[model samples]
Each structure stands twice: as structure tokens, then as C-alpha cells.
Target chain A: DAGVTQSPTHLIKTRGQHVTLRCSPISGHKSVSWYQQVLGQGPQFIFQYYEKEERGRGNFPDRFSARQFPNYSSELNVNALLLGDSALYLCASSLVSGDGYTFGSGTRLTVV
Target chain B: AQKVTQAQTEISVVEKEDVTLDCVYETRDTTYYLFWYKQPPSGELVFLIRRNSFDEQNEISGRYSWNFQKSTSSFNFTITASQVVDSAVYFCALSAPIYNQGGKLIFGQGTELSVKP
Candidate 1:
């Protein structure tokens, strides 16, 4: 079976722009979560969704949002990107809540 | 609040040497889960192991091993006979069922391991 997959492995955006990162969870998985990892740092939680409902959110700004589809796929959106927004966006999936998670390779975003 | 701390920012060892990475966690919940992940140069986070609060048994997998001690709230990983292929950034994480946050993992800053030939 395939693992969680993320799209546009790499992306570049200008300041004040917006970008959307997509993720496809593993087949049969029902939970999806997003994380952002800056260079030389561990990933920080962003948002988590289960069954198309928002279950958890991290210490991100209002400019960051995410939604999960019925198929368990997820999208992370960042508006008015700043230089600090540049980081690797990771998507993780699990069979249910409060379980071990599998993470995707991640989408590396660069804001200039 | 839940937090994971990896005090070692980085460690370098020659091939065939053994190295252990330290991880300390803080959480009030009695029931929780701990995990270790490896992020290679390719940048993908790979699952290494998971241990619940109830189980304190140390695990050994080939050249890798994990020591979970609830007494100290420490989960340490040891790599025996380390090889250059073992070089990567390793992360320690914690998860608990908070009021609204379920299964959300709080990750440590991560420790970069460099194994040289």
C-alpha cells in the first residue's frame, strides 16, 4: 500500500501571496494532520482533521487554514505569506485518533 | 501543556561507534504515547518506533534500540555499530488526548546525528 503523499514537492511564492499545499493520506486512513518544519528545527503542528471535521489546531496564525475531504485527503492554505512562512509542510495520517502517525515527504515552500 | 525536549542539538561519531540520543518529555496526562522518527537527507519523516505510557519494555531492532523510562520521563535511542547510513535528524514526539486536540504530536527540536566513515 502507498504511504501518505504530498504534492508540488517544492514551491516558491512571493511575500503577500497565497499558496495551497495538498496531501493524500494512505488508503484506509481517516485522520490527517499538517505540520510545518523550518530549517534546522523539528516540525510544528498546524492542523488536524478527521472525518472532514477540524479536530485540532496549533499555534499558527489566522492566515493558516486546512480542510479534510471525505476521502481523507487534506489541503493546507497559507495567505499573505511572509518570509517566515518558508518551511517544509508535512502531512501525516493515521487510522484513527490518538494513534501512531505516518508522515509524508512534505512540500518545501519558499517565500521571498 | 505537552512538550518534548531533545537536549542534544547534534552528535558526530565515527562508523562502528555506538551513540545514544536523549529525549525528555513533559505532560500531565497519565495516559499518553511517545514516538521516535527519522528524517533523512531526502526530508521524509520515517516512523521508527512508538511506546505507550503503560509499556516500559525496552525494544531492540537490529542495530537500533529504544529505552523507555517513565520514571525520568526519558525515551532514549541507541544505535549500535553505527554506520554512515545512520546519519540523519531524529525527532522525539509526545501525544496525548487534550480537550480538543486528539492525537496531535508535540515534537522535540530534534537531534542531528552524523556518522562518519
Candidate 2:
């Protein structure tokens, strides 16, 4: 049985550039949420998608957006990246119950 | 609005010692859920436990235990006979009513635990 999976374990981008992070939830899971973990801090909510529709969004700027595909995979896109955007991006998926969330190892983004 | 606070920024204890991580949460929803996660240096959040607001019982699982107090709005985690393997960042999180909010998880700043052998 596979857990949640994320792609490009590490990434580097220049300021004002754009980046896309990918995540594939476990089979049979429909809810996927994204989080950003800055160094020395906890993971902050970004966006959540369930059944191909966005159900919630965090306080991030419009430069950050995400969408869930029909297959339940998700992509988090950040535009005009800044140095502050460098962090570990995490993806979590859960069953309909939604409380028991399983998180991926996360993609470490470094914007210079 | 939902928020979680972990006052202890860092804690150090010798192996076999006992330690407790405190978590304070604020939420308006009458019923919600609390969770504990352990993240090692490798940087992955490992789920530890989950408790709903309706259940205030203290739970024990081997060397780990949790105390949930609704009156105090606290969900505390204690590790007994701690080991070096416990060295990591522990996070306390809160989730609003799952169905209504799509299970947005609000996390605390996290407490870094250092278990010296």
C-alpha cells in the first residue's frame, strides 16, 4: 500500500520565476491539502481540494494556486516566487472522515 | 478562526526520562479534532494520534499518552521512558468540523525535542 507521494523532492527557482509542485494521494483517497513549512516553523495551510473541487484556501497571496485532477493528484503553483517562498511544501490526503490525514515527505523549494 | 499554540519551543531530556508537550488550541466550532505529529530531521510528518472534541478521555499507548481537557482547551502529549529515537519536532494541530471546512488543519509552531542518550 502506497502513502501520499510528491514529486521533485527538491527544487530551485529564481525570484519572480514560477514553480509547480506535484502530489499524488493514496488510492481511494479524495481529499488533498497543501501546506507550506518555512524553516523553524510549522506547516501552514495553503489549499485543499476534494473530489476535483477546491474546498478551502489559506491566506496565501493570489500568486499561489492549486488544483486537483480527476485522478485525485494535485499541483501547487506559485508565481513570481520570492525568497520568502522557499520552504518545504507538504501534501496530505485523508479519507472522507478527514481527520486521519497522511502527509508526504514534502518538496523542498529554494528560491534564490 | 482556528489557532494552535505550543509554548515550549524546545526541550531536552536524557534517555528514559519523561517529558510532556503542551498544546493549546482555539476554535469556535463546538466539535473539532486535535492531532499530534512527529517530524524527524528527514522532514516528514508522522501522525501520532487524533482526538475529537467530544472525547475528553486520557489515552495511553505504550510509552505515549495524551490528556485532553476541553475546559482548558488543551491537548497535551506525554512520553514516558523517552528514548533517543524521540528526538524530533513535534507538532500539535487542530481541524475544524471536517465536512464543513474541508478539514483545514491549523498547526502550532512545534516543539523540538532532544533526547540525549
Candidate 3:
């Protein structure tokens, strides 16, 4: 079976610019969550969507937003990007609230 | 706010040696979930294990084992007979009760493991 998939494995953007990352969950999965991983750090949760609705959000600022489409694919949008926004963006999918999660390889974003 | 601490920033051990990664968590809520994930050089996050608050049983899976201690608020992972393939960054994470505010996950800084031949 296919695992979580993300698009544009690498990206580059400039300050004040906007970027959008994409993710497609594994087949039959209903929950999708986004995470940011800086160099030498663990992945930090950004947003989680379940059943096509927002279920959770992390400590990220309002400049970061995400939405899940009817097909269960997800997009994470960052506005006015800062150098600090450069990191690996990960997408994870799980079956339910307490089940194990499967993560995508992630999009490596570099904002100059 | 919930937080997880992994004091061991980096660890190195010869192949076949044993090593343990420590994780300490702080949360005011009584019910929570803990997890450990491994990220290999390929940058894919792999789920190692997950432990709920009520389950304190130590679990052993092949060469990987988890020691969950509620007293110290810690969930440590130990690898026996480590291999070069075991080199990766390990992350400890916490998830609040599903009904608490929102089911967000709080993560630790992570520990980088290097296994040598």
C-alpha cells in the first residue's frame, strides 16, 4: 500500500513571499497532520485535519494555514515567509485518534 | 502547555553496543499520550512506539524496547545490539487528551544517534 506522499520535495522562496506545500495521505486514511522540522530538531506539529475538518493546530503563527480537500489531500500555506520558515515540512496520516501515524518524506523549504 | 525534554542531544555507540535515549515530559493534565519516532538520514519519520498514560508496562520489540515510568514522567527507548541502520534522530512527543482544547502534539528537541561499525 502507498504511504503518505508530499509534493515538491524541495522548495526555495524569498522573504515576504508566500509558499504552499502539498500532501496526499495514504489510501483509506482519514486524518492528516502537518509538521515542521528545522535542522537538528524534531518535527513540530503545525495543523491536523480529520474527516475534512480542522481538528488541531500547533503553536505556529497565523501566517501559517492549512486545509484538507474532500479527497483528503492537504495543503499548508505560509505567507510572508521569513528565513526562519526554512525547514522540512512533513505530512503524517493516521487512521484514528489513538492509532499509529505514517509520515511523508517531507518538503525541504529554504527561504532566503 | 505541554513540553517534552530529551537531554541527550547526541549519542554514539559501536555496533552491537546498547544505548538508551531519555525523554522527560511535563504536563498538568492527568491523561496524555507519549510517542517515539525515528528519522533516518533519508529524512523520513518512522513511528517507533506509542504509550498512553494508563499503560506503564515496559514493552520489548525485537532489539527495541521502551521503559515507561510514570513516577519520573519519562518514557525512555533502549536499543539492544544496535546496528549501523539504527543511526537516526529520535524524537519524544506528547499528545493531550483528545477533549483537552484540541488534540495537538507537543514534541521534544530530539536526540541524534550514531552507530559505528
Tell me, by TM-score, which candidate is best: 1
Which pairs clash in the backbone of model 1?
none
Q: What is the fraction of true interface contacts found in candidate 2?
A: 0.75
In candidate 2, which residue pairs get closer than 3 Å at backbone N, Cα or C atoms, i.e. clash?
Answer: none
lDDT of 3 by residue, A9-37 (tens): 99999999999999999998888989999
Residue-level lDDT of model 1, residues A6-110, one tens digit each, is 998999999999999999999998999999999999999899898998989999999999999878899999999999999999999998876779999999999
Candidate 3 chain B superposition, TM-score: 0.96
RMSD to truth, every model? 0.8, 1.0, 1.4
Better of 1 and 3 by lDDT: 1
Please tell me the interface RMSD, in Å, for model 3: 2.0
Model 2 regions more than 4 Å off: none
DockQ of each: 0.80, 0.74, 0.65
lDDT (C-alpha) at residue B20 in model 1: 98
Tens-place lDDT digits, model 3, residues B1-117: 788999999999999999999999999988888999999888888888889899999999999999999999999999999999999999999987776424667789999999999
TM-score of each: 0.98, 0.97, 0.95
lDDT by residue for model 2 (B21-48), tens: 9999999999888999999998989999
Give the interface RMSD values of the models in order.
1.3, 1.5, 2.0
